[model samples]
Target: MVEPGPSISILAGGVTALFAVFLTFYLRNQWQEIQSLRAIQTELEQNNERVRELAQLLTGDLQRQQIDLPIEVPPGTKLEIRYVVSFPSSLSTTAFDQLKHSGMFLRLSPETRRSLFELYDTIDRINRLRQHRERIHFDDIGNVHVVIDPSELDVEPDASVSEDDLSAETRRRLSDLREMRRAMKGVNRSILRLIASIASPEMIDDLELEPFLGTAHGREAGHESNTESPRSDEVDLEEMRSILRDVERESVWSRFM
Candidate 1:
């Protein structure tokens, strides 16, 4: 067997050292990336929890109150309308803001970055809705009631509630609240999915919301696909639908002092 030359031995040692250095740096970088993901996951989890709480508050408290449009207040009863909204701006965005400002967010894959942006964007949208809701103002349609009574509820609604009454500006505020509530629910669901994706080894594409497409809303939204038959349980979403007095009669009550 031929003996190796000194020059060959030196070259082999140099290559081995270089490979070791590269592997060390590669592993360190991977560890750091995991740490960063954990930090972001923590912030997103908090955002999800808080938004879920807000959704619940709206769903529960709104059940106790009712403000159907063309709001007719009988003599001596008061109409009290209150919107309990939790603004997202108040929540801490430290981790997310840091990620964005440091350009770390840009480093993520297209699907991941898009999901993260969507999560934060939903929060921002709810905040904007809350702000816009407060600005909603309208001229009084008729007598304004400060409080409501069961006897007041018993009075027959004026059959002639006009289209203009249904379109009153005051109702816009309530509608905005409804939007915020819906967004709050959806955001948490997205966040949960995002969190799950983070822990998952496989990368995910964007999630598409497939709302029930068997109602008038389906046609209005321009969805060409329609169901041939309704499901045993059905739900619908319509912002402009004129279903008057949708307040839960069994779950509603009002008080005044």
Candidate 2:
């Protein structure tokens, strides 16, 4: 039942106008902030896309033009590879025949070649040790060191009374060493075969490689010009092997234990 006074009405109208003005300013500020956030989000997405495009250029894709390598492997060492739906299990028998026939070993960068050679050397050493153990006579061999020669021992002459007794064992070790050498040669050939396979399209099945290749091959349009395809010579074999070893160990070995 209170009657409105003129001064009170005028004061109420002024307060109401001030509230509306404040509300309008607040809404405009919020809108501008939203617009700024949208622009920043758009820029980030564009940057991410640019990064992806650059990565694609480093690796090649099967659908795009392929580069031929100059390396030629000797005969009989070639592999016959086939697509295996279940890999790692089929890796042993299913020859990547296409890769072997392609002579892609010629495409191995110097780094990859070095890694392959090192792997071959390790295989050789391990095989030689195995062979030497197989050929030894139980009595003639002393220490279990598979490839050690008794004559090479720095021990004093008094350590052994007889020299002729070791001749047979020594000869056996020599035979083992020769056989090991041959087996190692075969292993080196096998590693070369693996490199040849990787150099070809078979490498796409590996993890991260597809994305890496996709980004490297420049398969898409409207991408920034910064993307560069990695030539065969540019790949760091050591780094690739380290990554592959980790992936294999994580995927293959961890399952059994």
Candidate 3:
């Protein structure tokens, strides 16, 4: 074969160098995309855990309310009602926001984009509801006194408080609690479904997010396995009453009184 000319050789070298530069940029973009996906996956896992904990607490309270059980206060306790609301950790949207604005995410299938947007929207709704519930508990209902007479101990306080005796504010508060529990259940289901969808083989492959998807799938499986047995809403009313009675005789209660 004849030797190539100098101009042709220089042109070939230029093309090779240009291709290398393009490849470097392409690889860098892919690396950043993977990092963002991983961060989003981690946040999703942490948020799911917080949702589970909140759901459990709400379930217990809802069960007690449904059964018309008293707040487990002893008779003549003269206790002050303190509404201590423990808020869950806020869900991080940093990675999700970044991905949504990125070109890579924009190139994703429209269906996938819609699904992601819906998931984030639902999370936003849950966060807003949580803040509203906290405001109702802390600002609206602050601290109320539960002045229990010694004679009232023989009968359940809930039983003694007639419908006519319940103030409008009390009724509103009860309604708010029930609504919050329902909202929480909805949020829990939505989150679980989102996790399952993102961890599916097709979605994982399309997103090129193997490791993050694997971790998410594992966490989802663990949660489902642990919850295989349905939790009974029923609680031991007598046991709760006894515990409260014991607390009444304790030095802490006496000091507060």
Report every candidate's CA lDDT: 0.41, 0.35, 0.47
lDDT of 3 by residue, 47-151 (tens): 656655554444343344331333334433432333344666655567679877665576555755565565565456556555655665555544333333434
Clashing pairs in 3: none
- The digit string of per-residue lDDT tens for model 1 on 45-120 reads 5654554444444334335434434455544444565543443333346776766654345556575555556555
Number of clashes found in candidate 2: 18
lDDT of 2 by residue, 1-257 (tens): 66579779998999999999999886665444333333333432332233233223222222222111211222222212111111011111112222223223334456654654443333233234333323332223322232323345444444441223334664465444344433333332222222322332443343234443322324332242322222243223234445334433443323432
Which of the two, 2 or 3, has more TM-score? 3
Count backbone overlaps in model 3: 0
Best by lDDT: 3
Error of 1 at 225 (Å): 22
Ranking by TM-score: 3, 1, 2
- Candidate 1 versus truth, CA RMSD in Å, comes to 17.3
Q: Which stretches of candidate 2 lie above 4 Å from their native place?
A: 1-4, 60-257
Model 1 segments more than 4 A misplaced: 1-36, 60-65, 69-92, 103-107, 134-145, 148-257
